[model samples]
Target: MVQVIDGDTMVVMKGEESVNVRLYGIDCPEGNQASGREAWIFASKLADGNPVEVQPIDIDRYGRTVATVHVNGRSINEELIRSGHAWVYTQYCTNDFCRDWLKLQSDSQGARSGLWAAKNPTPPWDFRHSFKLAQATPQSSKPKAPPASAASYHGNISSRIFHDSSCQHYDCKACTATFTTRQQALDAGYRPCKKCGAK
Candidate 1:
């Protein structure tokens, strides 16, 4: 693997190409969410610099490859759940193997491991939904400065999405394009990030 981007995403070399793989059946905390750093550290320890096996499952809306990664025959997706670093992501975990992962999640929760240690840990999906809502809310009516000259926005050429600096995905590998303002990105046919409210 080239590097571990977050708790559940990593860049792996496929021939001469680098593919972004989102671990299947699990959802980790976002970079700004609770236990997010710890989850990334754990995943980094397990996968970074280690050769892994990727079993492709599907392609996500963001153009990420959803797959189960294995290291030394151990499933990293399952390990994340067992270690309490991620949730079962039941929305897409329809296979029978998900049952075992669900059990692991329950056990982790019962043990109060990792993020489960929180009094009421927020799921990543719920946190993302809240972020989206907060982003949608109107801002101050005060006059804002004109669009800055510096390129402060990152655009994902493939996904056609743009993200500001505040976004965890602002430096995503696919975000090779840059824009001086949100309007520039919009005019260039890019949309705001759903996670960070880049608009």
Candidate 2:
């Protein structure tokens, strides 16, 4: 692998191309979330710069290659769950192995491993949703723009994603729609910018 982006995401050298791979059937905490750094360190030690096997599963909405990765004949995806560094992503895990993975997750939770050490740790999906809700607060009751350049929220019409000023893509080529508040973008059916975690 060329780089371990996080606990469950990596950039691997697939032939001459660098492919972004999302580990299948499991979800790890985001880098900024609880137990996130520990999970990342463990995954990096297990997989980074190692010649590993990638078992292709499916492509995700973000265009990432979803796969099960193996290092030294051991499955990294399964290892993460076994170590309590990840949770079984039941929403997308349709394969038969998901049942076994869920059992492992339960065992980890019962043992208070990793993020489960917290009495009630927030799931990554729920964390993301809460973050969006927090950011969705309207700047003002009425919608009005001071100026085009001063707009706080920017939307990419093509991708249907909105970015805040903090994002590098806030003023990207496709970001023609401008909003005074994040709620305006959300009301228009635009999803938050994943990179900046903008709502």
Candidate 3:
């Protein structure tokens, strides 16, 4: 079971037969990135081409076993994420590791390790769609950039921005004006300034 096929998939030998197992509760990036390959390497090292204790929860539509794999008393799913090899997948997670996995992802992201190295790395699911679309259509026109002056201040129209800094990007989109400070932007009913990358 030590050979990694991809970020989230592995091949394990079960009673002399090979079985494909999709790791549960976590999502690694696609194979196109360095982080994706790192994830595969980490999983392979954890599995060590040996029989692991796989507790299958269900069979996914792709017929792969969706399971929590344990090797040497450690949960491979958690190890992959905590070690910065993978990300916790909230959309399809079925285990208690979901929250912990998310925390691990956050920690990795904060450290700018693996996938976090990219300025904006695409999620695996989203990357899949983008890949399909790319295959269907050849690269052509460049996307048009938004106008710098296309912005408006919110004033009293929106008060919620004052409390939540996350709304900055949305406010920047609506106002078309970037702000120097989050507080100033929020006071103007413009959320955080996206152009300045206020976050």
- Residues 101-162 of candidate 3 have per-residue lDDT tens digits of 78878888898877677888777778657744754574477634424332222211222232
- Arranged by lDDT with the best first, the candidates are 1, 2, 3
Q: What's model 1's lDDT at 161?
A: 86
Clashes of each: 0, 0, 7
Estimate the Cα RMSD of every predicted model relative to the unseen true structure.
Answer: 7.8, 9.1, 18.5
Q: RMSD in Å for candidate 3, one decimal? A: 18.5
| Candidate 3 Cα misplacement greater than 4 A, ranges | 138-199
With candidate 3 superimposed using the best TM-score fit, by how many Å does residue 26's alpha carbon deviate from the native? 1.4
Q: For candidate 1, list the clashing residue pairs, or say none.
A: none
Question: Per-residue lDDT of 57-89 in model 2, one digit per residue for the tens?
Answer: 998766678999999999999999988999899
TM-score of each: 0.74, 0.72, 0.64
How much does candidate 2 score in TM-score?
0.72
Worst 10 residues of 1 by lDDT: 142-151
Please give, for residues 1-199, the per-residue lDDT of candidate 1 as tens digits: 4466568877788889878788898999875577876887798889867789999999987678999999989999999999989999999999899999999999999999999999998998997688668656786795454355432677775676889866889877677445556775676467999998885
lDDT of all predictions:
0.80, 0.77, 0.61
